[model samples]
Target chain A: MEAWVRKLVTGCLLTLPVAASAVAASEQAVRVAVIGNSPPMSYVDESGKLTGFNVEMAHALCATMKIRCNLLPTSLDKVVDAVSAGEMDFAVVSLLATPERRKKVLFSKPYYRSLSIWLSKPSIKPGSPRTTVAVVNGSVQAQHAENQGWKTKRVTNHREISTSLVAGDADATVVPMLTAVSLMEKPSLQALGLESTVLSDPLISGDVCISIHPGRPELREQIDAALDEIKRDGRFDRINSQFLPFRLL
Target chain B: MFTTSRTPDNYRHKLGAGVLLCRLTAVFSIVFASAAAWLAVDQHALLENMEDLQSRTLPNSMEHQRLARNLEVLRLEGERVLAADNPENRRQALFIVTLMAGHPSLLANEKARNLAIETEIFLTRAAQGSRIDENIRDEWTRISRHLSLTADDISVDGINLAREDVRQMNGLVEQTRQKLHGAVALVLGFLALLLLLIRRMILRPLQQIDHALSDLRQPGSAVTLPNYSLRELASVREAIVQLHGLMQEHESTRDDLQKLAATDVLTSLNNRRHFMFLAESELTRAQRYGRPISIGLADLDHFKHINDIHGHAAGDLALKAFADIIRSTLRHSDIAGRYGGEEFAFVFPETTPQEAVALAERLRAHLDAWVIPLKNGGHIRLTTSIGIADASAQALEDALRLADEALYQAKASGRNRTIQAKTTQLPLPLGGHTDNSGHSA
Candidate 1:
């Protein structure tokens, strides 16, 4: 019996570090990215905490995967670069998984769809010298607008797009449907004579997938399975109903 | 139905062809109905999508089509601004362009929203006391035509989206067809499996039962019983087993009754009637095969005198001793029977007349030495007189008559002797114990 106990002790000692390392790996903090000022999609609350559809979805996905996540607020333009560079494990922001972006990063199954829209007043024509359409710098909409040879005033975030329109620096801005909805929610922006026109352009695929870190295909599969799990369990619908007026799925 | 070695207890539990067919029909019906329902639902969804495109997307495109038409008029108005046909044409052109630029399609298309927005701005500036110069006309013409092209592209995009929707509907139809084929294949496979089971469990067992019934008529041919899974077939097999047992019982009973009819109870030998039957048949076979055969009659010497001297019990004991001697002396081919009273008949097959005399002498000698014990401690020595005749060349009746005459001659000469009938008109003195000695009680 003494000899058996000694053998068991030796066996446990040999396997202890392997078990501990696995625990450590599971316990490691995964950095999740969120944009600063895309309301209802992701934005800072009054308490200076990031909380929105994307942040809540990230939390739910982490819960499904049973892992710890750290939501990091980043600029809208830097989400793709941060994830591709492995600085962030994944981003829950609404980024269209276009074919060009697939080369640099892996994408989960699309969580929702988006469309390009022009946010402006009905009387004031968009993209005038005085009413130049405001678009986020380094975004698909900005690229599409520049490629289409339209006059654009580049901004950094959704808040700036809304503010530049209200401040009279820009009279119109081409944004996604959700952001347009967000801006339209502000009666101040509406009272500022701002309206929205939804667009159907060939350049817009509208499929918003979770952009995962490049080279982490296993994590991508884990995220995809977790995403499907969340959708199946009604967590996705719950989040969609809480954040969006229209169904995302 | 098959009847073989099967348990009667739960044999009823096994599924028969009818039940199996019902279940197969149910499963097939369910599968067919499910496939139909699935396809119907998919077709309905496809139809609804097409309807959505027709009712919603198509009507929505009319708005864009109007926008395109409005842009063409705006471009013509820009041409009027460039023509300078009247000083008021510039203000009128600006008024027309501004109202047309406010159209939703102008702002909806990223490419054209800005072009129309900026053209409206330039026209406003020119209408506000600015000169309608070549640079202003050039800008107005360029922006208005570009916006017109952009409006046309937007309208066409709506139609292309509709075409894509129709293409997707086509894909759904193809997918539904594949599902239907899969369901059909599943149904066919299940039908084949059901048929195989019927052949194995039903048809094959029935065939084996049929073979067993046909084989039952041949004696000693083993009946190969079938193992039946179905209860009805098993009960049939059990009934067949009972029938086979009854046939065997009947055969054994027939054999027992025949034995009782032909055997003599007292002597454990054939009786006179059956003995005659056997003798006649043997004589016929001997004559046909050209084989020698003999007949003989033997009597105990002074059997009644023994009964008169020492009670009938001692006489019967003496007769039984004589029968024992006859039984011990006969060959396998020889037939012997008690022919009423003290007489016993014998048929010696494949035997010559001289051989018959030799065997009869041996029987007399065996009887002569035999002693019957009496209850009074008295012993009776017994003997028999035998008469033999060759029946190979004569009819059975003539042979018996000749043997009877020879027996009379032997009784005239003496008692306790064996005699051979004269078939060649001469006797070779074939009688044993034909001396002047008789029974001494």
Candidate 2:
């Protein structure tokens, strides 16, 4: 009876480890939510189908890493909230990687970049020191203006910033380079004496990236590896082609 | 206590009938005049309200169109700025922003001030260098986000507030229109109802009373008019009852006075003097108004022979029936009266010489066809000779003499026929004889 018991105990020990391995394998399928809203980046269609540049890039990255992916359709503001709350694994909103936002969530390498421009009243001389500079509150451009020792004021909205420059409340203000280019083409801005100068040390540069939950090092490493593979295989170029004319940095 | 005299009772009945007829006629005229005046006032008010609505709508529509045009101009300017390429383009954009801010309604909001600051930052970056910096681009994004938020707020909240204001204005306009229409309808409705009541209670009843009085004037008429419901109409009825009584009491006295005056007592027809007075008055009216005047004279073929053959009573009956026929043939505007024993006269004002001839011929034919019933159960055939004369504005004596000559000619030519005499130099009637009686000119 003692010899038979010893053999049975050895068989039980091997079977127990096999069952545990099966449970761990099932649990290894990671579930992640990516929040975004920009067209050709991430958007939900009339059919409730999610699509766009961010969606395609996320999928490509997920396939490389062999991980399950999910897209959460939300406004740009909600993207930051979702990522911070851990309700989402990450977000792909075209958010500028600013110092303030970095305090709350980790950002990946910038996937896109854009330049800052100086907008001003046409009546004010281009290089005048008295020209008032306007920037959005809590934005990277505001920090840049503050660092340059330029006369800066905080504004609530971009439209108001434009209006303030026209109204003589501010002689100049900061905005995206593309937006400034678009504004210059309009006849109304000409009649209002509006002009713009693109800054060499850009007032701000917008870099779109995925925002992860704070301190998720293992997941971060996995996403980084997947992104590196996507970049290497020329998938990023294919994704960017879908969003041409709006160049991705 | 109930000892009533037959004479006084008969007098009272006649007086009551006469007084009631007079009062009813007076009340009918008054009510008709009041209704006409009220209708005139209501028509005027309706015209004034229509004018008011037209004036108010025109100016308001013009103002709304002007504001819409201004908004279009501003939108077009905004488009141009978005397309141009230099630092000046940013200034243009800023100018449009400021223009929008200056609008009183937009300036009241805190969001407008925030948008102004964002605009200045955009301008500053554009002026700094040829290429836009990264920091400025992020600032532009934040400004764009805030602008979109404020635009959404304005659309969802501000537009709703404006919609409420527009709705209230519309409600006020509708209410004013309704009130004006209601007032006009009420005034017109009251006038129509009052006219209906007046016709029923006053005019119709007055006409009935007049018919009753005419019946009482006949030898034996037992017709009695129905009493009116209203107090004023009842008072009129009472007055007619008093007048009827007075007429009964004065009948004999009036007969005695008629024998001395110019009226025939038996037939109660106007006598020679009264006929002459009426003819003169009609001639004067014709001359004043420039209308034609005519006269007709009729005489029995053999009045003395009838008095001798049929006796005096038979002669009297024949004269009475002939007088009744003459009165029936004459119109209400024409004057018919006894000239002498068996002769009658008529004054037809506003009648041409041709019309007078036709009327005289009709009278003669009617007399020839008459069958006068005698007391002895037999009917007598009667014939009369008639004469007619007309003048526009000449001497009355000449007209009378001409008519008398026509009568003599009729008798000479063989009785029971009519002859007409025409005067020279009569005025021609206006509007050349176009038979426009049924057709409008």
Candidate 3:
């Protein structure tokens, strides 16, 4: 009975977006969620400003579309829910589109492709269920690790995967090779005999597209068109060259 | 005899059927094998691209994405740590921070790890305070925020890697398609060339053989068979030519064999069967025209003694000598034969008993004077006994019997003598023409 009441309340909260839509014509700022966790694409700088490829691209797109942009910092697990519940318009989450997520949101055109990676000591093999992987909580790595039948040491932050590996809470850590570049360059990793390998798989790695609210199908088209415009203008390439050693688009 | 050469022009290195087949097989194999090998290489390259995607880039991108989300969660937890005043908030924040800071990248790093450590220490000490210190909270925020940024960088890199994999796959597919097209073209070309080779090597030569056959079939048609480019065709033509030569030779040999069949091989005389045929014709003519004809039989005397002394070779020499003497004494119209071993018969057409007796005496005189040289450094003289009979009214067999009886009488009277049979009208079998074709021996 309590569950039914909560469901009713949540359902009503979902309809609140219709009222918001009524005021949307008055140039109401588009609320955009940014996970701000991925770097070079979306992350906070040392200046405590959300500045990365994704952040800059969003600003560029908003400026071109002549729309006022309101940025929202959201976690990866909550970004989908926040946007789905009409609390946000869209999210700049960098994960590739998956069939499961497609059921909830419309995905913008792919901004870039990505690779998954494994970090482990040379003497230790990283596969098999016996091996525990340090994965971020509520992330694809967690799902992938569990799907492999391998135990995962779930962490709250990207840094925790490395910390978990050092603490021997996990036999290895799985992340993108780019994010772990600094960790891999550390002399201590060498002292620890840890090496990183890029894990290439179609199922887990591919184009990273922006996820849009399903209620805003037009927003997905607009974003996709804007993405094409930025690429044509060389803005996407310029940002990619500045941050990465390889092309993303 | 068949004339052969060590390197017959017929069996030269003309385009042989076996060589043509081998070349065809070789060309076909090369085309198909190269095609198969190319396909295998293309498939292998594509498989490599797929393996790379499966094993490395995909897994890495997936992991980084998870880590990126986790870092934001960590930052949210950090804010929670600062905002909450209750012991529950502090306790949860401390547990999360404590677990995260345990990783080597967090603790071992100089800048980020130190802040994470200070935050952990401050949170652990928060039991003494009501809320997290504002200054420590700021530092914790920076630490988590910076870690979040690192997660974003990793995701970008993963995305780039995945893009590279797809690009490589697209290129491989294009290359394979182009190579496949080339292979297809090569196969079609080989088939066309094979058709051409069949015309030059197989089909054309067969038509030549057909023409050669037509030429051979027509009589008086000049047979002009040229050497073929293909060895099998040339060989067939050569066999046909040789067969033609053999046929011509066989025709002439048949005529020679017919003549040899009626003539004696050793004495070169009309053999007994042929001699009787001519004698019978002569008797029929004499009987019909009321003309005279005589039959005579002769034998070499002391012939067994000569064989015992000088072997069958000497006896043969004696018979041949007797035949030569008869051949010399008789006219072309007369017929003579070695009737048996050391024995002979003669038919003198248009001759009476006296005329035959004269001819027989001449033959006797020649035999009496003839000498045969022996291989054993010796010499031998031969003589023969003869008898004549008038056969103007008698059948061939009766006449031959009368002459044989008179020949026996001459042998009894003395060897090497001639005698005449009394003109006998003795009754005998009429129209007696029983064939006596056999070796008189």
Candidate 4:
């Protein structure tokens, strides 16, 4: 009887964590794409750790849904493809929805608008006809400039656009208004005053939305419901004000 | 009529088709600007969330989940240690347990960490061939439960933090949406108001001007422009007023030219053709109204003899003097003109033959007393013969012929005197009248 009791005790101890693993395996873990370069949305910080609005939001959403989040850093251009290919579950980045992207992936309701504006040297006139405008490669601003018949200088990102303008490699550049604002805060950039507060008026776009894999309409619905809850609870506002200098819906 | 000079003020103040469009664009721009500004701010906020997720929330959650996984591994390995039937398997399980025990990410809670340390020690002793008892087994079970509980607590904290971050982001998105909606509403309202103003102040006035111009195309139309309060619209009204005034002036100028064409250049009076026309018109009116009208003629006595003696220049002076005297003597109701050469004629409406004689006498007397001045410093006296005829039962042509005959009679009777022509059916007046041939002076 003592041997029987020992055997039962050993059986129970051995099964504890294995049993937990079995239960977890029955549930799929959420996969999230995080961009390590895009700031304010999702990026790697000075501490060399992945964090940002998108990353935090993804984690929080997973927590709200009672799922495990497996986050992976990805390139901006590849995020959609990764999500589409099911290599990643969802992507949180400074992504804009376009027809081509919509074909491959589903987008959540827009959460913010793209407030792009032009920055140029003070010596350069505002809206100089036919002047080359610099834009981030693979960005909506670049496409917009091209569509408007303005010559565009494509770079890697907003910072590179600013650098291109400063280096006189481009006549002017379009960046998110926030990026411009922050650039203006820098003394070096301020020295090169961008004459016009003229925004990308005609090109300003609608709200920014989340991108989900095409087959995951249910996931999108779940995320949307979570968003609705946060909105009603005023939690969204708090986080928005904490991260953004202005309010967006 | 309001007339303003074409200055920069007019151009500066002019409103046109673009104004309304500009207003709508401005409203839209403002709304879009507000939204853009908000988005920019939100982007910055999003950046901050990124930082929080990467640097804080995500890292903390990862650490917590990792520790939880480690604890699970340690729990499973502990089971392996308990179930080990061989020394080598027991040693392998003990090694893994020790690795988990020493992991830096292990739960910081003293109780959980202590439980892991205790499990590692028990397993190490088991690997060292220590005797196992019911008490040890029970102790192991209790420790395992505590370790799992502690890890669970830490993992839950991480998950909650992650959830809070997502809630925050979602909240921001909703807030942005609300802001954008409000901005759109404001823009729409402004655009509506601007459109209404444009319709009333700009389009309405333009339409009125269009209507006025159409009316002006009709004969004898009067231009009446509507009042406008807007500077540009008012300027348009002013332009229409000036145009209308210009049109009226042009009409007046045309009438003046017509008058000039009918006037005698030298005498500054109605020429012979106009006088004849007037005579005919007056005769028609008298016949229509049943009012008596008379025609008369006056001639300078021996006007050709004077021209032959004193030069044609003197004759011209005399002629001018006679015209002046006639003009001075005739009432405004009477019409007189240079009939031809030295002959002068008049038509008096509502006048009897007797009254015609009286008027002819007065004109003849004035002419007889007038002196002509010459450029050569010599003066000459001039006189006239007068003839009278009444319209009574006569056509205009007949009256003119009778007047001409009467003038001839006056010359025949005597120069410098008046005579009345006899009507075909009526006898001539005998009082103060003569039938003698008038001698040339």
Find the candidate with the highest lDDT and give its number. 1
Using all chains and alpha carbons, the TM-scores for the candidates as numbered come to 0.51, 0.27, 0.33, 0.42
Chain A TM-score of each model, in the order shown? Answer: 0.86, 0.56, 0.81, 0.80
lDDT of 1 at B295: 90
Q: How large an RMSD does model 3 have?
A: 23.2
What level of docking quality does candidate 2 show?
A: incorrect
All candidates in order of TM-score, best leading:
1, 4, 3, 2
> Clash totals for all models, in order?
3, 111, 33, 27
Among all windows of ten consecutive residues in candidate 1 chain B, which has the lowest summed lDDT?
B1-10
| Number of the predicted model whose TM-score against the real structure is largest | 1
Residue B187's lDDT within candidate 4 is: 68
Over 4 Å off in model 1, which ranges? A1-249, B1-156, B163-178, B185-189, B196-201, B218-229, B306-328, B372-379, B434-441
lDDT by residue for model 1 over B1-441, one digit each (tens)?
233445555566766657767877898788778878877888888889888776566545544554565556666766665565544445445444654465444555566667667776666676654467777767766776686777688679767767777888898889888988887887788779878977987788889889878877866566567767776777777777767766666777898888778877677678888898999999999999999999988877777888888988887777777777778888877999988777888999999878998998888877777667888987888766778898999888898887777776666667666678988455455445555445421
Residue A37 lDDT, candidate 4, scale 0-100? 61
lDDT of 2 by residue, B253-314 (tens): 78777666967786668888888887888898898899988888888877777777788888
Q: Give stretches of model 2 more than 4 Å off.
A: A1-82, A95-101, A121-138, A145-173, A177-194, A200-203, A206-208, A246-249, B1-441
lDDT of 3 by residue, A84-104 (tens): 788888887676687777787
**Higher-scoring candidate on TM-score, 1 or 3:** 1
